[model samples]
Target: MFVNFRRIRKCQCVQLITTCLVLSLMMVCWEQLDNSVVSHVKSYSYRYLVNRYTFINKSFTIPREEAQSFSNFLYLLDHPNKCKGQDVLLLLFVKTSPENTERRKAIRSTWGNETYIRNTLGVTVKVVFVLGAPMTKPEQLLWNKRAGLGLQGELLREDLLNGDLIQQDFVDSFHNLTLKLIMQFHWAHIRCPHADFIMTADDDIFVHMPNLVHYLQDMARKGVMDFWIGHVHRGAPPIRSKDSKYYVPFEMYQWSSYPDYTAGAGYVVSRDVADKIYQATLTLNASIYIDDVFMGICANAMGVSPQEHVYFSGEGKAPYHLCIYDQMMTSHGHIEDIYHLWKVATHPQVKQRTSGLAGRLYCTAVKLALLCQPYHFNTYPCKAAFL
Candidate 1:
């Protein structure tokens, strides 16, 4: 009996030691996690609270010649009262790379050929190529060498180089680019002075302009104009790695749930929302995420809700096969796929596919439409009766 009791006692002692060890290890881990959180928070707090507008005005200035030209253009374009209730403007911001020439050509061609639809739908779309510095005039000329394609629109050079935009010290540069684009839109409204809705998209995106118009028209009918619309994901963790360009230290955005932030590849904000964003910029300091997420968080702070829609894809995948049906917008595609996707989206026969044939056609048609389209920017008046 004594022997059994001694054995039981020894087992209890072992269990107690194991429990103590586990508790100690857990405490250490908790401390480490706490330290990490605190360190991250500290790193961002200073940067987050700094006023971006002050920095822009104080640290950065547009050159006199450029500033005067920009001001003159703005003076010519600004007409806030000109924005009518029915007009919609689409803005496509493209980051041109050498490998993307064919893709760019395809997009330009699609835009060129779709004039009839735009006129009918009462939509005006402009593509602005925001070229990186490494992309020279020679390279741009080479890409433009091809004829018979429809790559047209304004080419706006970014003030900062590729490296300059991404440098850690140039947080202000990021905000400046975004502000410049917004200012451009503001000027566009003044110039045309009648657009009701503005769509901002990336070069990689393929927009189903007609469908987008219909959707917005329906939304307008319902009297909804102050909201931001795009694809939204729940519980996206803030990027924290030092190596990543999208790193966000914890203090600036501590929450794991980004309330209804849109995937920036394609999104439409009403004119009121656009004005609100511009106004918000006056007070909000810029956070270092890609332009899309930054817009989301900024809109959130300004009381603009991002309504989630499935049409926008942040991941580089298409919603459907390119051959089967018309794609409204596909975010990331290889050079060939981008070209084929644009061709398929704009093809009349491709649009007529009613069922499973759409899927099968994508695979076969992809190889058939590999030719590059030429680029030119001209106002194509829509032949549609509404216009």
Candidate 2:
């Protein structure tokens, strides 16, 4: 019946120490926890409970006259006739910086090569490098009246040699990416309206042209419409941190969850969807600077949901293996080794190694190992191993 007073006092001290330690740990991790877990909870709640994005449309819509201001940039370099007189299967737009000439060269030699696509794949794919005016340093802007004149000359020469550059007059900065997005859709609506499909990809991304062509051919045969496929981002919350490059202030977005969107790394839209997106661009507020998020807004307004493609990679590089190469539609973040990847990925041996019962079994095991990781590789989702 007697209480152990000393033991109780010791227990109280231990509890106090434990509480302090837990508080210290939480303080250290609170920012990360809020950024990830708390944000996701808020996003999902808004996405499901609210269930209506029409408000976004009503709020973001502007007069087409006002909207045209964003897309009215003059074309410094263009190939208006690039897709003319051809039964174009896919009009591929590579979102590129003005300085990434080497990356463009690498792409032309590998996946984006129109000659290889025409003769080898027997599909008419037009590759166009889309860019805005080169951005000069703020300090240099004062002295140089025409800040990008030298770069313009080089771009003109490059466009003449390659006949593939589509350069607009707006300064090519990350904040102006939505303008580039508008440029692609608007240009496509005018110049390449007959193309069966339109694909937009980053400069550093590797597209398996053969696989992509075959897939598009199959889809074309199926008479696919409203087809927009890539690595989809669903119910993603905006980053509220001002210090982050991807920060979205409450005044700008105000939404808890963004409508579903494909990764801006690479994505494909059928001609019909492209037209719909173009129409959306004519009226929607293009003030949202994140190109992919803006794309989501546009698609949401059009009631076009993004479809996830297993072979289409997100921001991460796909695992370097024949199994991955066999079906890869796109692999992002390939800067230096694109040529090497192209050579090995498209090797005839890949088909040989990944065919038949034995090959299938081998590939299944390989994919399970590479894709079904304990942590996300951000290449292919774990479910892709089965596919």
Candidate 3:
């Protein structure tokens, strides 16, 4: 009887182990199938949305030797003396006016400055200002031609005054210019080429570069590349009417549903993703909405998904501390709210006071810097050079 009982117990144990093994294999297969389905759905959707658009033929191929040389140049830029092992984060600012330029400088100098951010986060950061064209012009060719020249030159030489270039009727016109500037920078990368991640931001927004680096590092570990990370707004209403600057006719974008896209005020795209977007935009007609919707929503139809995190603020009204505590990459602030942004970013009392009555002197200093001054003159046949 004891021998029979032992045999039965051994058999029961073996069966239990076999069942667990089979279940584990099945779970793995199920997970892979789920991922495959999601990927397939995304691929089909992109093809359906963008197959009919005029394709832009731009090659991102730098010769093997040239790529090595370019990589060396970037290495030097990141590690000047070979002592700092820190990676460089490029902050590309898209500015529209001298006023915007001043604001950008101030924000960088006060809170968004590379020095301050690097010291705090222990990483190297550099800011590149890509001055954008005025927002008033709807004509793509004219805007591109004029923007190819510096903003000040365009103003003085082309008789392009603010009133002539900007239509105050559209509140988001400035944001649209921001989109154009992002495209311009992406093209610049194709021309010049540098940096691991390209962070595009507006003059009026506040960004924490350290947080962004951490977020991106995590994403890299997850094997995520060729993707955009930011605050995503899905199913936003399309602009209507010919008279309105934000108007989008049914013919322009026939799709009723838009994929999740990032808020344009600030977002990071991998080098591969940036190249894809630049190519996609050349084939697609420019949209008239703000930067986020035009690029995030429209380009997303081509398989871009906005990465969600704790930091992207779409409301545009919350305090900087709230955003910072959330570990956000970018937060929006209007011209009038610049002081508040600065104060909250720098001051200790920021966490305490959300409102105030006292008037503080927020001077918008204007400085005129010459175009193509000291920097390498890009005379090469590149798309950004045309911009």
Candidate 4:
């Protein structure tokens, strides 16, 4: 009787264990099924919404372009050896007004100055400013006065260190900005196509040349080409309100959202795509107010896409943290902040730092807190959001 009772208890224990194992397997299967259903719903909903949005805003127009000629715009006065030598690493172009001589001076003294870059970083850099022809004698006088040259300044300043300016024959006005942009690409396409990389920035920007050089080297080593990189804006809608400075009329561009484009303030491109974009400019609409968006349209027509980088601040300055500033490549709208920014960025104490994991973490948290700060911060007016 005792043996039979023991056998019955063993059988009951085995049945209980088997039941628990089956129950656990069933729960796992149920959870997976639930998750799969949820994922499917989300995927379908996203696709549907995106399709609907695009369908609603679909727009197109045939540009009434005549036999466009960029050759008529060549009013170059001083053509420097844009690249130091045959093996030029970067051809940096700064877009400036004919009268923005102070900004140009500040740039040459700071980031745009290539002497320090070549001497210290061992990278060949060429700095050139792109401008359009001045309308009147006073405008010409202003340019020559600020640039410190005579009436034959263009001819005489050929050998001058700071004479690396390219002034095309187009009327120098805000409306002619697109012509100015295309002219740069055309100059690059014909004059300096063999350059490894090219960059375009505004006169008011503060560029950390050392950081930019390192970034370019990495891209070159990785064999990156057809490259267009900066602070990319995706699906940015046109400013329809007439009161705004960026207002775009429907007659100009019917599309609601402009194609993805890097900010015009500063961007980098490889040799492979420079010519392609120059060709694109010949056919794409050239009447857009914003030069960056116009370039974006040209790029889109050629099926080339813009790559986004956090370091390139578009239309804004980056928040001033030591680590953040050290890593940033470009910041915008620094009209008067250029000198101050250069001082802080190149400070010796900020350069030599020994930080462990904890230090990095602490700085990152602090930056995050600052990044999400409410309105009325430096990030505003400067557009200093972390890219």
The candidate scoring highest on TM-score is: 2
- State TM-scores per candidate: 0.54, 0.93, 0.52, 0.75
Which model, 3 or 4, shows the larger lDDT?
Answer: 4
Model 4, 200-288: lDDT tens digits are: 99888889887899989999999996799988876666666677777779788654467778889899998887877887766555767
Sort the predicted structures by lDDT, highest score first: 2, 4, 1, 3
lDDT (Cα, tens digit) per residue for candidate 2, span 27-94: 88996886789899999998989867888889999998999999998998888899889999999999
Model 1 lDDT, residue 309, Cα: 58
- lDDT of predicted model 2: 0.92
Model 3, span 1-387: residue lDDT tens: 437888898999999999999999999998767755664555456546554222211122334454232112111011122113446544344444533545654665654566676777665555544433343345655654434335445444322221112111121244346344444444445533444566666677766555566776676567667667666665544444456665657665554434456766677776667666665554443433455655653455456667654355453633333313223356666566666655555454433442233211110010012112344121111111112
Higher-ranked by lDDT: 1 or 2: 2
How far residue 201's Cα lies from its native spot in candidate 1, in Å, is 1.4
**Which number leads on lDDT?**
2
- Please give the CA lDDT of all the candidate structures: 0.49, 0.92, 0.48, 0.72
Indicate whether candidate 1 or candidate 3 has the larger TM-score: 1
* Candidate 2 ranges with C-alpha deviation above 4 Å: 1-25, 137-147
Q: Measure candidate 1: CA RMSD.
A: 13.6
- TM-score of decoy 2: 0.93
Worst 10 residues of 4 by lDDT: 55-64
Rank candidates by TM-score, best first. 2, 4, 1, 3
